[model samples]
Target: MADEEEPKTAFVDESAVPSAQASGEENGSLGNSWSEVSDMRQGLHQRHVQMISIAGTIGTGLFLGSGTSLARAGPVGALLGYTIIGAIVCNVVLAVGEMGALLPLSGGIVRYTETFVDPALSFAIGWNQVYSGCKSTFCDKSGKAATLIQWWITINNAVWIVVFGSVMTVSTLLFVRVYGEMEFFFATLKICLIIIVNVTALVVVCGGGPNGVATGFTYWRNPGPFVQYLGIEGALGRFLGFWTTFSNAAYAYAGSDSIVVAAAETRNPRQTIPHAAKRVFARVAIFYIITIFFVGLLVPSDNEQLLSASGTAASPFVIGANIARIPVLPSVINAIVITSAWSSGNAGMLNNSRYLFGMAKHGHAPKIFLRLNRFGVPYCAVLLITLFMSLAFMSLSKGAATVFTWLQSLVSIGALITWTTISVTYLRFYYGCKAQGIDRNELPWKSPFQPYAIWASLFFLVLIMLTSGYKVFLHDHWATESFISSYINIPIFLVLYLSYKFINRTNIIPLSEIPIRPLLEHAQRFPEPPEEPKQGWKKLNIFWN
Candidate 1:
């Protein structure tokens, strides 16, 4: 008698598996191929998932870019701006958690789109995310082409792209499981750095410096707080400055949703995802609000130090530290920024690989991406995404500042699109649940305020996107060639969507027929673990021994 085939989930779709297998062989070695990979091995620990999510959101952008926002908006303006953006980020997180918890599949937003909207929409979202991740990586310090070749051969931005991409690819291949652990350590390091900076600034403001002096919030009073540039008369310049600052604040919060990329690797994703999602608001509130508030209090917004935008070393925190006569703090902070850059780059590469893997699994990309190494890593996808991320180095060759600005704009636009999709997906999900008569109480985690929260997030994101491009419409003098290039990413997205639709002959489905119910039902089966118990003295023994 023939041996019985092993049991597999009906969802695996064996017919689809053949294409992926064929593609795997043609591309390259699948790496670590093994039969009978266990689900537990595939799943990441809850701690890793939660920490990675937090690390993903707190990037070099926050450390290096917040200073620019402070300069654009006075203390008060910057505070208010971040608060508003935080609210929007909170709403987006809730919406994502709702859909993510309901369908804990690796497809993430793409899967949500497929279930709540159309296949084409899913394809577009996944591919766009992949493209955005790759594009954004160029700004990573290690990935800069000029820096890479400066020590050796002279090459253009193209060479930097390939070089950085190869490095990321190798890194991803060498350490898949350790990525989460590394993120956890990096997050801790960043958190410590912020704490030190905040404490030092507070000390300086409270007369703890060598001279026992205080700035006394004089910066706000002198500038009269605001830079109204567009006004025919009074405070209009201040308002425009505030707007520019707010845009920077929003950009700082851009990649918060990166946590979703690791959904596949998360253990008990339903619980882990919801728990992680709930933290977004608190994280933003504490981190952004408190940090900005203290900075405003310690260093006046108009200080010459604050106005400098030279590099990461010229960060407002560093500038404020130097002015306050703090010894060695600036150098320490600079070192932290370098580490933060690496952490952010690592997270970016990880996310891009997952996005590619999800696309391949769904047939939106080549099947080779679906192949996993014995370590259960998507090695092929990781290699390709790393390759593309190196393209970010091209900015260094062309001009670092120009490349950074344009890429930053693209990142903002990509995030806006993603947030919009999340809201719309949730709206459809809400009604789909109702029509199917599924009780809300049965959900593992339900978003509060129902459809209102979803709509509110959508509204805010649209407003940001419009306002982001507002400079182009309002002031002729404000128009720069770089400003125009910033908006190019939006058109790129539209063209990609239209071209895919035309080629695939895809049509949007009616809201009634959305496949949300089935996906939700399938997801509901895998419940999350209860919160981990608080550590006791005995718990420390495992590490000590």
Candidate 2:
């Protein structure tokens, strides 16, 4: 299937018409009408988009994985790592916001890559996202399974995997609004939990808790705020620890890039997408950075329970709550962690299904994926992606479980590649605008910094991808699987991009040849809907809704 020939449809470089019309003119003879066929419903509101951007990212990565990072890198290392990655995330989100507002499509950046960059790039990134989403869902369920048994010791993890997987699949197959509402509620729960936990952590850090023992920065001073990596001594070791924590930070922010993927199903995307993208920085600052800071202050980095296999103990916040002697807060936090993990799986399902549907619409995937039901849900694509959710069952087997971990590692690389591609595509689009004498001010949205931000993000992303597994290359630290998991996707991405270019005889689209006019005209034709004033206390919805 990887080597399948590209469709020999005529390439219409002109953009006097909309993309759907132009595609019909060039590919009509090939029965390629799916691009014109609207299979998705714009059932999502501005509130749903905002919530999804927050909910998709604030999952096990921040809640559970942060514990491991603290234990490995110490308080200072973890803070620096998350702070750096958060800045990169801000840049990527800004770039995506500018592009998505101009061309708000179903698959967001995946579709943008096809139109603004290369179709071959789109193909590679699209499949990469789909695979990542599937693996993420599997991992979410596995983590949820582990957390579920913490509540009850008798049940097997396989049962929770099946149960959680089934629930997410059903929701994905439903109307898009159902999924949106589901995510909205889950995201609200997460936002509330973060606020509550952060405030409680502050209480513990100060002497407000029942224990009345002030523990302000005591852990940081005791642990000395830097862990030596692999028992290596010196600055190099601390640097390695920070670098390792940087990778863990990536996992915390994984699904963030896909925040705009559902734009095609959102109302007034020209307004909502850019608006939602702007909120990401605040969310990261409050929910991630502040929370991590307090978690470090409350929970010592050297505590063994930070790396515990048990769900409750592995949570730094839960452990801190226990130490503060907060009545019943530990159990409450544990339950929220389980729900957040399950929520991540649901978000993954939504992203994967839409990605497949977008690919099918553009002829990058099988035609079966183009099928949509009465509610405009891409049922076929949902079912196909949901099939992979069964992989969660592999956790029951010892040997297959090891393979599952490797697969998860491969998927982790996909986000880095996707972010790199986003910056690259934005650069191409930026240059294309300049060459064509287009006014950037006329665009619906514009990023703060231009080519510099794009280049810096690209350079850093590539550097991280190359060095993600640097430890494996150190003397006496070599491991075959670790080496492959870190570097394998680089070659795989190249193969996919090069092979598609070769098969299709695709060329680097010249700036003048790029189709920007029709897109701008289309966007202008659909001006954003005006906001209605809210009366009374309902106006507070503007804060988060």
Give me the candidate number with maximum TM-score. Answer: 2
Q: What is the lDDT of candidate 2?
A: 0.77
Q: For residues 1-545, could you state the per-residue lDDT of candidate 1 as single tens digits? A: 01111221233222222221123422211111112222213345566666666555575467767766676677888888888888888888887887777665565787677556655677778877887766766454444323423323455546655654555566666435577667778777887887888787777777887668876676667664654444424577677777666467666776687656666556567778887887776678767778887777766666665544245433677777777877787777776666676677777777777777766655678988877765667788887875565455455553666666667777777777877877877887888778777777777688778788778778877877767866666656566765665566666667776777787666565655555544455455534446666576857631111
Q: How many clashing pairs per prediction, in order? A: 13, 0
Q: What is the total number of backbone clashes in candidate 2?
A: 0
After superposition, candidate 1 runs with Cα above 4 Å error: 1-43, 140-167, 229-233, 304-309, 395-398, 478-480, 523-532, 535-545
TM-score of each: 0.84, 0.92
Model 2: per-residue lDDT, tens digit, 71-119?
8888989998898888898899989999988877678677778777777
